[model samples]
Target: MDYRVAPAVRIAGRCRVPGDKSISHRAVMLAALAQGESRFDGFLAGADTLATAAAFRAMGVAIDGPQDGSVRVQGVGLHGLQPPAGALDMGNAGTGMRLLAGLLAGQRFGVTLTGDESLSRRPMARVIGPLRQMGADLAAEEGDTPPLVLRPVAQLRGIDYALPMASAQVKSCLLLAGLYAQGQTCVTEPAPTRDHTERMLAAFGWPVTRQRGRVCITGGRGSLQATQFSIPGDISSAAFPLVAAVIAAQGEVLIEGVGVNPTRTGILDILRAMGADITLLNPRDAGAEPVADIRVRASRLRGIAVPPELVPLAIDEFPAIAVAAACAQGQTLITGAAELRVKESDRIAAIASGLGMLGITVETLPDGLRIEGGQFRGGTVDSHGDHRIAMAFSLAALRAPEPVRIRDCVNVGTSFPGYTVLMRGLGLEIEEA
Candidate 1:
């Protein structure tokens, strides 16, 4: 699919984005492991999360209706899952594949996981090494990439491992595996990453201990009780419109029920540093996760050197942030983001190339990008089949001099399914072709 995004005079409206994608994936996984039916409200109905659901169903867990932000999973208990008939196809979800590796490591039967070209090329070695260290028979492709094969293990032993880098997926993978391990499993991160796994574990009645950057969990101690909960709006998905509203010529937008978890609020902090006019309205908690309404208005933005410490926090959001930087007043240097090179697409390269195509003075860096703030002239660009890249370029249309045509945007459904519709409703002129 391609999107021709024309310049917008104003973007105004109150919008609610889909439920948090990360949390939605974890919710389905955890629920599928529980002893009984687990119901979820405000669940993300994206293609990626649905892939997670489908994989679980193939394993004997009965999941119904991701319809209208609600899903019910008839869990098969910790040890009740039947071996799937064939390889679990995770499609384009790196999160589903990696985290499922942990969950399947301790299962009684072996399973193979494969994906599309984009996901197949993603490095799986990070999760592979850890799972192997924990005594699971696991192997990846020659380049440490995907088509991960896992052989059933008699038992998994818990280990205290420190992550070489800050990754929520790796941490969550190990933590999920810990549930079936013999002893206490601990993961000490170099920096704080998203705590969706820990938070959801605790919400499911599993005890999780966190001290500074280290998180520890004891396996085989308790059973996960199936429970009901509401998922907050995804702040990551909200980022495109948030940046669009920031760069728009007029009006304000209120994004309601957004998950404002501290570890995941790096984009908010980065935007504030760039002098974005943002406000948090009606702050509260949706279970352990924090929720708030985000109000952003048109503001003159000035680019600043984004802090390294905040890089991990806003890692998933850099594509949109780069769009904001392009519309800013000065130079924006983003460093400590080497992780961006390994996402669904090489985000740093994709963002730089796409922005350069749109007439932005962006210099690609080994770790990040050096973007000089300037007006964007609409032009043709490719999304590299990455959802974030596609959406980020759509936001560039808000400030573009002409219609910006973005290609390979069909993958946008992987994360934010109704993104173009939502943006169009906000008064942005986007047409699908």
Candidate 2:
């Protein structure tokens, strides 16, 4: 579907965004593998996380819906998963394929994992290589794209795997594969990615041991204890509202219960550097992952160069970050983000093309983007059916000279359902096109 967003005048209010998508996906997968009933509080009811839950249930796991915004997951343990009734479709969730590959690697029953065209195009070799090392029979096309057919290995033997890229999805997949490995399976990251999988594994009483720069997990655990988990608010989903508040003339917004994992808060750090009045309040440890209320206010933003070290923490936020950069005073150049090319859309080209259409100065590079902040002449832009790109332009529309028309906002439902309603509630003039 298409959405029409007008320039926002001002926004000054508090809103609680949805639960963390990363944690929500892990919660469903881990809970499905647990030995008893698993309870989740504050779980994201978004379409993506829901796809994860449904995918697990298709594998014969018992999962119940959002009865009061919480879900019940019945774990079947490491080796207890039943063969799925049919092909498992993950939709647009890259996390689903990455993490589920680990669990399926050691299963006694072979299964096939597939996704939508967007997901099918994403390179799965990052995950496939590691799992293959652990002796899982996973088959894909020549390009390492999905339609992954995983054959039963009875048991996956543990091995140390090093990632070429700093990807949490790859690490989590290996760690999940480690769950069924014969011995200690270790995955080391060159840079820290989101540690939701590690944190949640520890919460489940799994033998998750971490050392300097590396995490090792042993397979063949007797059984994982079932427990209640409170899913924190998603910082990624909260990003739109956060940026909206910062860009609007006089808006101050407080977002409650967002996951504040330092590895994933690059947006907050980048915004702060650009002179945003962002703060973390009520910070506390939830399931070993930090959760807090985010407070943000409008500010005169000045652009700054984004370092590569912070890339892993804020990878998902770059689309929104591009918006923030566009509203800043100077030039913003992002490098070493070649990873963006393989997202839901070719984000570098998509963002550059979209913003350029709005009369913003955008220089597209092979890896990253260079944007010079200036007046945005309101215009229509295509989202390329990417959720983050859609939301990014929506936030930018607040400052656009005229209404910004974004095509295919239906993808927004994948990660942030009710986005139109949410932004409107924040006083944005958004209409369905």
Candidate 3:
């Protein structure tokens, strides 16, 4: 499928994006391991999250109704998960696969994890190396990619490991494994990544300790207690329309109930640095995460040098940020984002190529992109089968002189199921093609 987005005269409205994908995945996984039935409101009923739910169901956990963002997960306890009938397919969720590797490592029965083509190519060595350090018998296909196979280990011994790079997925994977390891597992990160796992672990009644740049958990020390939670709106999904409001010629947009966790607010900070008129309203706690309503108005954006320290925080939202940069008044220099190359797609290259097609001057770099602010000339761009790339370009259409056609956008449903409808509701001239 493709998306054909036409120029918008105005972008104005109040809307709420889907629930946070990362939190939804963790909620389901941790809930399944808890001792009672846990109910979740505002869950993201997207393909990737549903895949995680399905995997748990395959292992004999009963999951009901991700309908209307409501789901109920019956906990089977940490040691109660039954062996699956076959290889567990994670679809396109790299988060699900990596975290599951850790969660399943200490189980008595062996398991295999597979994914769709895109996920199958993502590097798994980061999680694998840490799991190996804890004595997990895990292996992957060549290039440390997926088709991950694991064998039962007599015991998993926890180790204090430092992350070579900041990764929430890797950190969460190891911590999940720590739940069953023989001793305390401590992970120190070089920089802060998302703390959803740590927070969710604590919410599930698992004891997790946190200090500056470090999180530690002891194996078999506590059991997960099933608890109810209401997931906040995904800032990553809210990013596209937020950028739309920034670059649109006229009007304001309010995105309500968004997760504004400090670690994941890098996108807002970067856009603000670029002169985006964004504000947070009604700030409050939503379960274990922070929630706020974000208000943005059309503003004259000026591209600025993106700080490297904020890279990990805004990692997933860079694609939309690139669109904002393309429509800004000056050049935007992005660095310390080498991780973008390993995402669902080579985002740096994909965005660069897409912007170039729209008559934007973009210099592709190994770690990032040098994007020049300029007018967008409508054109067709391939999404490289990446959901973010597809949505980012759709937002660019708000500032285009003509319609923008984005190819290979079928994957958008993996994260945001009703993207076209949601964007259209906010006055973006978008539709499925």
For model 3, residues 35-127, the per-residue Cα lDDT tens digits are 999998999988899999999999999999987899999999999999999999999999999999999999999999999999998999999
Q: TM-score of each candidate?
A: 0.99, 0.98, 0.99
- By lDDT rank, best first, the candidates go 3, 1, 2
Residue ranges of candidate 1 with Cα displaced over 4 Å: none
Native RMSD of candidate 3 (Å): 0.8
Candidate 2, after superposition: displacement of residue 213 in Å?
1.9
Q: Which structure is stronger by lDDT: 1 or 2? A: 1
Report the Cα lDDT for candidate 1: 0.93
Pick out the ten consecutive residues of candidate 1 with the lowest summed lDDT: 73-82
lDDT of 2 at 105: 85
1-433 per-residue lDDT for model 1 (tens digits): 9999888889999999999999999999999888788998999888899999999889998888988898999877888888999999999999999999999999999999999999999998889899889999988889988898889889999999999988999999999999999999999998888999999999888999999999999999978989999999999999988998999999899999999999999999999999999999999999779999999999999989999999999999999999999999999999989889999999999999999998999998899999999989989999999999999998888888789999999999988988888999999999999
Evaluate residue 431 in candidate 1 and report its C-alpha lDDT on the 0 to 100 scale: 90
Q: Which candidate achieves the best lDDT against the true structure?
A: 3
lDDT of 3 at 348: 90
